[model samples]
Target: MAMALETLSSPIILFFALGLLAALARSEMTVPEAFAKGLAIYLMMAIGLKGGVEMAANPLTGEVIRAFGAGIVLSFALPLVAFAALRLTSGIDRVDAAASAAHYGSISIVTFVAATEVVQATGLMPGGHLVAVAAVMETPAIITALLLARQANAAGGPVAGSERGELLREVMLNASVVVLVGALIVGWIIGPEGFEPTKPFFVAPFQGVLCLFLLDMGLSAGRGLRQGWRQLDVGAITFGLYMPLISAAVAAALCWVLALAPGDSALLITLAASASYIAVPAAMRLALPKAKPAIYLTLSLGVTFPFNLTFGIPLYTAMGQWVGS
Candidate 1:
């Protein structure tokens, strides 16, 4: 309860709430798109570097390998569950359901970042390798989604003017993956001693930058909800709200099996629970061109993201503490 209150009242979450409320109220306040993109890049780079530095301090071990395996398995398998749930519960067509399922299976970097902050604030430090785990988890769900679409014969023909290998390029070379993996490698190469001089830029300002970025995210979510909510039926909307919990429960069971510590457990659970708004959506645009962006984007950014930020983090944290203890 205390953790939940703290999370809700944190400066970053509050800034997010402010932006969400502003947008929901139809306020015209806006962050420049270019600037928001810049913010995203900076956040990704900082996190990657930190994770890399941590990896440099520790050697890869069996536990780390297991965590990676678990992440990949989750990435590959969760969409099947999500797809099944959507098909069984909602009237959505296979293409849209598959696309939306992909989003649920993928990790949201921002949500992972937010969870890192909360976990650390509670004096539990997650492993740096989890960052690499996050990067690895982004693309497999996309593959699963495409396969699901293909199986249902819902993939249809490719979009006109689409060149072969375009989807592959987009999935592999997307900005999020490239920046994150690249930055992690750079940080690993430099190590802690080399990172000292750069702390002024990447370390000190990280929190404030995240607050600003999340405020923009809040605005985006609010606008998406306002504009797209009507497109969702009760079943679809409820899926957005409940799916994360289901994902988190699955992750927690995995953490127990793996015997992960509290901090790492919290982060992994949070990663499992988060849905991608950036990478998967862009890929879905190419691979499943027939899928409606409004459904997936709105569910991810509007309903799931807000729920995770305000309430889900605290609950996941407690679950982590329980399982780890």
Candidate 2:
């Protein structure tokens, strides 16, 4: 428990807390929306470049392919479990449950990045291909959730005033997914030697940029919790806190089966456990409009995200070590 508190009180989480408090207090402090968006893109590009450089140093083996494949499958499969859990445990209806579950199953690249930093701080080395795993894990849960929504609302008419293909477009080309994957591919094509040319801009500014991004995230989460938290009852609120641990435990078990190294195991488990704010939330806005974005967004972004960034990363990393060993 002391360890958990130490992890939670880390500078990154504290910075995030500062933003959350500022937003909740209705401080006029703000990061320009356009600037925030650009920062997000820059962060993605930096992570992708780093991953590609690492992959260049290592050969792409069968294990790498297997890991990516497993990530895709888990991303596809976990939504079913999450959907059932939401239906059984929360007041959320079918459409909302399905939409919310998709977010839980999808990867949060920021959370993964944060986890990577934590593991590195602990002197553990995660595989660079984990970035590829994150890329592969982005879209499958969105697809599964859409399929679930289609089945649940089959008898009912289509969502009113919703355009055709909006959900599909959002799922396929959400800002986070497009940037992360595109940058990953760019990095792969350029390789480490190629990435060196842009290192000063992409590499050096990363930490400060992340701090700024987290500040915005904290503000968004605070405002969200302030507005939408009442929608969550006790059961629902508890789910936000506990589901990541559950997901991580399951993913850790999978890591053991796959014989993943400690570092890579932890990274994959963290990705599985971290719920998407970027891709899934935007998709929910279009796909499940009747569903309250505030509720799920706040729950995932406001509640669970902070939890994962703070204590959940360390817990999962420790668990991954125990299991992988």
Candidate 3:
């Protein structure tokens, strides 16, 4: 309860709420798209660098290896679970369900970033390698979702004018993956001493930047919900709200099995609970052109993202602490 209150009261979350409220009220307030994109890139780069520096300081222990394996397993497996749940509970077709399921399997970098802050505030520092784990987790769900689409014969053939290897290139070289992984490697190479010179830029103002980015996100989410809510039925909307809890439960069990620390466990739980809006949408466009972005994107960005940001992070934090304890 205290944790939840604290999270809700935090500046970043509040800023997000403000944006959401503004958008829902039909305010014409907007963040410049180019600036918003820059913010996103900056946030990713900062997180990636920080993770790499921490990883550079530590040896790759057996536990870390196990964590990586667990992340991959969750990434691949959660989408299957999500697809089943969505198909059974909602009126969405196989392709749309598959597309939406892919989102639940992948990590949301912003949500992960928020959870990292909360976990750290709880005095548990998650490992930096989780960033790499995050990067690793991005694409596997994509593969699974594509396979699901193919099985339903919904994919049919490549979209006209789509080049060979285009999906491969998009999946592999997507902005999120590329910036995150590249920044991690760079940070690893530099280590702490090398990172020190740039601390002012990367570390000091991180929270403020995050608040700004999230405000834009809140606007985006609200706008998406406003525009796309009609496309989502009661069952689909309900799925958006409840599915994270299911994913969190699965991750909590894995955390117990892995004997992870509270901080790392919380992070893993949050990652598992999060649904991707950015990368998956783009991939689905190329791969499953028939799948409605209105459905998947709204569910992910509109319903799930806000829930995770406000209530879910706190719940996952407590769950992580309990499991690790």
Candidate 4:
């Protein structure tokens, strides 16, 4: 595990905690919602483009395929575990649990991005296609969660304002996935030499840009916690903290079984462990409207996201090293 102080000391995580604390303390620190949303788009695009450029530099290999395979399978499998756990432990009904489970199963690009930052901090080398792993992992859990809900007969009425295919559109075209995947394919087609032309804009300011993005993230987290935390019970709140850890453990074991390199294994574990805030919540709102956003989104965005950003990524990476190395 990463030393508590070490993780706490990270500028990114500290900024996150500051936001959480500020929100709880009722400090009116606010990011203009539109601006924050723009930052998010910028971050995703930058990361996606960078990953694609790197991928262009390195030819695809069996390891890349294996990592991607692991991502897909993990994305599909995590909701099953979360579904069983949520149903067993919480007061939530099937639809809520299934919707929530799908979130656990899906990837959080921010969390993955945060983990990439931590990996670089730790001097670890992960593949560019781990970004692709992230893209592949986004939707499987949505499918699984829907299946679980259907199997349990938990499709709770036409979820609020959500027409039939609305859920499909949300799941398939969430901004992060579309931009990330689209950019990756673009980069792949363009290749490394072709990437240099865009390097000035995409690569040059990534870190400073990331810090700006994180400051907005901090404010958004604080605001979210202030607005939504009342909906979480002790069980749900605890679930938020622990579920990512549990998912990470499962992903780590899978990576070990596949004998993946420590770096890629860590990325996979991080992706599995991170819960979706952007994509899943919107879809859940559409697909399972009765399920309280306060419980799941706050748990994900407010609770789990902060935890992973601050502590979980480093710890998961350390564990992946122990297992995969």
Q: lDDT per prediction?
A: 0.94, 0.84, 0.95, 0.82
Residues 1-325 of candidate 2: C-alpha lDDT, one tens digit per residue:
6556766877767888899999999888989999999989999988988888788788988768867877987899888988888778888888778878888889888899888888787778988899989987888898898789889673246667877877778777877778877888888888888998899999887888888888999998888888888888877788898888888888988888888888888898999999998888887777666777877897789889988988899898888777764
Instruction: Give candidates' CA RMSD values in order.
Output: 0.8, 1.9, 0.8, 2.0
- lDDT value for model 1: 0.94
Candidate 3: list runs displaced more than 4 Å.
none
**Stretches of candidate 4 exceeding 4 Å from the true structure:** 1-4, 157-164
Q: What is the lDDT of residue 173 in candidate 1?
A: 99
Clashing pairs in 2: none
TM-score of 1: 0.99
For residue 93, model 4's alpha carbon misses the true position, in angstroms, by: 2.0
> How well does each candidate superpose onto the true structure, as a TM-score?
0.99, 0.94, 0.99, 0.93
How would the candidate models be sorted by lDDT, starting from the highest? Answer: 3, 1, 2, 4
Ranked by TM-score, top first: 3, 1, 2, 4
Segments in model 2 whose C-alpha atoms lie over 4 Å from true places: 1-6, 154-165
Worst 10 residues of 4 by lDDT: 154-163
Q: Model 3's lDDT to the true fold?
A: 0.95
Worst 10 residues of 3 by lDDT: 151-160
What is candidate 4's lDDT per residue for 70-109, written digit by digit as tens? 8999999999999888877777778778888988999788
Candidate 3 per-residue lDDT over residues 1-325, each given as its tens digit: 9999999999999999999999999999999999999999999999999999999999999878988988999999999999999999999999999999999999899999999999999999889999998999999999999899899688788677989899999999999899999999999999999999999999999999999999999999999999999999999999999999999999999999999878888999999999999998999988898999999999999999999999999999999999984
Sum up the clashes in candidate 2: 0
